[model samples]
Target: MIWKELKKQWRFMDGVVIASLVVLSFVPLVVFSMNHKENSAKEGNIAIISIDGEEVDRFVLNEETKHKEKTYYPGKDKYNIVEMEGTKIRVKEDNSPDQIAVRTSWISKPGQTSICLPHKLVIEIVSGKSSDEKEEDDDMIITY
Candidate 1:
């Protein structure tokens, strides 16, 4: 007798319960999609083009030299530059390991003082050409 009474109550509430669950599930999916879109849009390009017309795809700043060199001081943050034939991309620091595709025009021209990219801006430049063709050829000569 008690079982039948409880079953009747549950049957009447079934529609409401299912509707609530469906709404709950939908909320998270919506939130997740929005979050993913925001994250994807934030990723930026990382590259460096020297004033001397030299393009370096992969570069690592000597930590010691970086500390001493105030000219290329990257402030407190860490960054990397990905150098291509015609463009240089700047990648900001983040914990996540992901590549950002950035398409930006060059702002600093050759023969300009303080032209070297900050040491913190280390980036991996992708090249399709042969190794010899992808040499670090820059017109700006580094004088010590």
Candidate 2:
């Protein structure tokens, strides 16, 4: 009688093992399908344009460009530091009368140019081209 009960329990256990194997086989397939769907919906095209004086650089970014900001260190000359925004720019200056012009244009959108410079640096912005000679004596310009 005990032998008959053991045989009956083994029959039910065999079915449970087969059911688990079937469920396990479907798990990887489900995961792969979801991953494929997500990858297909991702964006793959983006571009960034950078220009410094006469030099131009262009490249692509994997993400969208809702907004962007860039700072350029032309050199240690303090007069070369520039910040650009969309087509607008601002340049820093010391007490130099050299004509420095910065032009920025986006390749993706042509016909848009931005010019930026310190108010004191622009010849038209300032009256009679006066220099900020006192600025050189400020505490900010002096270093220990």
Whole-model Cα lDDT per candidate? 0.38, 0.39
Q: What tens-digit string does per-residue lDDT give for candidate 1 at 1-144?
A: 999998777865798899999999899899977864453334322223332244433332221212111122234543333222323323322322343322322222212122223342333433323356436543576889
Question: What overall lDDT, based on C-alpha atoms, would model 1 receive against the true structure?
Answer: 0.38
Those runs of model 2 whose alpha carbons end farther than 4 Å from true positions after fitting are 1-10, 44-144
Q: Give the range of the ten consecutive residues with the poorest summed lDDT in model 2.
A: 121-130
lDDT of 2 by residue, 25-99 (tens): 999999977864453235222222333434433322223433444444433543433433332333433323443
Model 1 TM-score, 2 decimals: 0.25
Write down the worst ten-residue block by lDDT for model 1: 62-71
TM-score of each candidate structure, all chains considered together? 0.25, 0.25
* Residue 7's lDDT in candidate 2: 82
Question: How high is the lDDT of residue 144 in model 2?
Answer: 81
